[model samples]
Target: MTRTSAVSLIRSRTLSDVAEYAYAATAPAGSRLIFLAGACPLDEHGGTVAVGDYAGQAARAVANLRTALADAGASVEDVISTRVLVASARQEDLVAAWQVVRDAFGDHDVPSTLMGVTVLGYADQLVEIEAVAAVLDEPQPEGAACPPSA
Candidate 1:
């Protein structure tokens, strides 16, 4: 399922039959931008989750991305863009990975780029995702006392 969010997604009407993902996204002013490290398809034990399987690795990568976003006080809905890296020259392998990511984001459909790369850092790592997200900070109450500076 797809959904909209704080980031605005843009699609080109003139572009013919492009992929389902949006072509661009824009975050609003006053939104905090979060830059995340590339999320890898690794299990909690630091082992690659999917050996030689593009789709499986992509799924793990998305889960890792979610964890990273949570750590940064964001979620998939706040994502503004992503770069998907698949370790294969074959288009089908890239598509296999892209399908998993696209579905995971549902309609949030943040702007993204998919690339077939030569290799990734981890063993048997067929997919990785690097993401940028923006989230608005919660408003302070009127006359709210400010906390002491750390």
Candidate 2:
């Protein structure tokens, strides 16, 4: 496996799992790449976030994505593309859910695709997010600055 660093917004202050803090910055060259599968509003124990709440579902979806990225040695900043899924008939619900998704992905204006679906793998899951990211082997160029975190 390739050596990977954790990309985060806030550095851990204690010994317990510390999240790194990173701002908006370009990635290094020849970075390792990883694509994350679509993540739904499922908990670590295979539980649903919100049964019918779009916002809650969206939040969980993004959280799940984060976990997946961490497991794969990647971060939201590494993600370059995303596909968003929503299962709702009301446009308002979808818009609300999208906002949640936007907020979760650091709101860095990353590339994303939003789609309306009739249903998801789980009946209670109303939101799903999938993405592709590149993890750099080194820091940004000598003169480059890291991007601000969301």
Candidate 3:
């Protein structure tokens, strides 16, 4: 018998071709959840990188997303959902941005939503992404030694 994992992928019963997303993600019990603010395509100096370049902006935004996750003691693998906003109506631009996001997420296959917008917070910003992650709390084995405090 194949064992099913606790991460349940919920989908609409009547919907077809919705494989790209999970309508709902149910994390395992005792999971620590973190919701990160929207990450923009700004560099460390607070300036947009590669203005007017959708793919470049997407890459920067994904990099910032990784930093945010690391700061919270989480990794991309912990991400359960993501919302990607692109400041363009063109399908090609949106696809370009999405490809960058897919590269960042790797094999996690987390649920994601991509949207096209007229504008964003920054004047030259082309992409913004926000994410939610669930860090599972693994139970320590009985009688395990605790590490010393720093």
Candidate closest to the true structure, highest lDDT: 1
Question: Against the hidden reference, what TM-scores do the models get?
Answer: 0.89, 0.69, 0.79
**In candidate 3, what are the lDDT values of residues 57-83, reduced to their tens digit?**
999999999999878767777788889
What is the C-alpha local distance difference test score of each model? 0.89, 0.71, 0.82
lDDT tens digits by residue: candidate 2, 1-150: 655532223323454442122222334556666777888888778888778898988888888888888887677766766778899778888888888877776545565677888988975788888887777655569989865432
* CA RMSD, predictions in order: 3.6, 11.8, 4.9
Candidate 1 vs candidate 2, lDDT winner: 1
Candidate 1 residue-wise lDDT at 38: 96
Give the per-residue lDDT digits (tens) of candidate 1, residues 54-127: 99999999999999998877799999999999999999999999999999999888788999999999888899
Ranking by TM-score: 1, 3, 2
The candidate that achieves the highest TM-score relative to the unseen native structure: 1
The regions of model 1 sitting more than 4 angstroms off are: 1-4, 142-150
lDDT of 1 at 8: 85
Question: What's each prediction's clash count?
Answer: 3, 10, 0
TM-score (C-alpha, index-matched) for candidate 1: 0.89
lDDT of 2: 0.71
